[model samples]
Target: MAVRDPAIDHLLELLAPLGAATARRMFGGWGVYLDGEIVVLFARGVAYAKTDALTRADFAAAGSAPFVFESRGRTVETSYWSLPEAALDSSEALRPWAQLALAAARRKPVARKARSGEDRRG
Candidate 1:
């Protein structure tokens, strides 16, 4: 049997109030989703919430740092930011941040141009 990481369990518990959040193994960690939209990512024992222009400043003000990784010798910064220390206290404490994450996740994605030879028609 696979041993479940306690961190994953804890994150789910904290997110329970938000919705039926689920986690899937990914990138040597977990990707947490709510209502089919990914809102959080758990990596190296840290929980990162999705952020957008609207909420990035809030996270920054809370002293949260963005999720970063190295790829092909280049640093990649993602739109996810670590949950603030205060939010780790409980679901109630985490709710507002979680809500912001969910809102960012639910935002409409930008449209991308079709690749060469790809169908652009309906």
Candidate 2:
């Protein structure tokens, strides 16, 4: 079952503009898609985007930690990024970053390993 939170609902409303593209409810939150590709995960009221070195710098400049999925004494960064604090203060500011992520999602998703019966061992 999915847990409910007011903050997450508000975020979903904020992201509803792209709802027709692709989005699924899982892990107690929503997975946002752009052009049928998942670029951001809306969870716990934060936006986690498709990440890379350049994107990492962008988030740092905006002043926020990347949505980290694991931390065992070391900070492991994920594609997730909290909505910039400054952006959260201004509604206008949020759209640009969200657009950036959507653009990333529009790219072709990288295919990993075997598709089906092609592999039996790693």
Candidate 3:
């Protein structure tokens, strides 16, 4: 069963101008997608954006921290950071940040192993 949250739906509406944003239940919250790219996630009433080297500085400049959690007796930080304060209310304010996140998502390389049916000889 997929869990749903009204706040996530509201957030998607707020981000609509950027593109068609959709949400899916994931990790006890929701993963927000824009043009099929996962740019944001919501959990515990807070929102986080996917971050990479290209976008990390912007979040740091905004004083936002990467999502961290305790696991296996250690602290683990994810590649996602909280949305900049300026983005919380206005879609205009969030456009750039969402663009950056989308860029980062595009840059993230996908891992795919070679299929046995494929010929490897070159």
Candidate 4:
């Protein structure tokens, strides 16, 4: 088993009411998975939840911003949004928001593979 981040562990505990949530370290951060889907992430003591176009307005209205990172000298914005400051303090407050995040995560399109002999060699 990989070493777990204590901060991530505590965060997961608070989110327990949401359902079976598991955290795994990835690229110096943590990925929070629920129901076999990644719904949240923990990094630098902040929790970022998944968001799609349909759900981004909620975060925006709450004054939350999408996760941004600099890669190769360019800023990259992701679909994940930081949880509201109030929600970070209480699991009860975060429940609804987490649900919306999970719903948005499920909305992402799944990758499909090409069928056998269906692709051109060009």
Candidate 3 structure quality by residue, lDDT tens digits, 1-122: 75567778777887899888999888877899999999987877888999999889988999988888889999999988999777867788888888988999989999878798988777
Per residue, candidate 1 scores C-alpha lDDT tens digits across 1-122 of: 76768988888898888789898999998999987889999898999999999999999999999999999999999999999978988999999999999999889596798899998789
Q: Over the full model, what C-alpha lDDT does candidate 3 score relative to the true structure?
A: 0.86
Winning model by TM-score: 1
On residues 1-122, what C-alpha lDDT tens digit does candidate 4 reach at each position?
77777767776877888888888777678899877789887777778999999999999999988888899999999999999988867788888888998899898999878788887565
- Which ranking of candidates, highest lDDT first? 1, 3, 4, 2
Clashing pairs in 2: 48-80, 67-80
Off by over 4 Å in 3: 1-3, 114-122
Give the clashing pairs for model 1: none
Question: All candidates' TM-scores?
Answer: 0.88, 0.63, 0.86, 0.86
The clash numbers for all candidates, in the given order, read 0, 2, 0, 0
CA lDDT of 14 in candidate 1? 86
Overall lDDT per candidate, in order of appearance: 0.91, 0.63, 0.86, 0.85
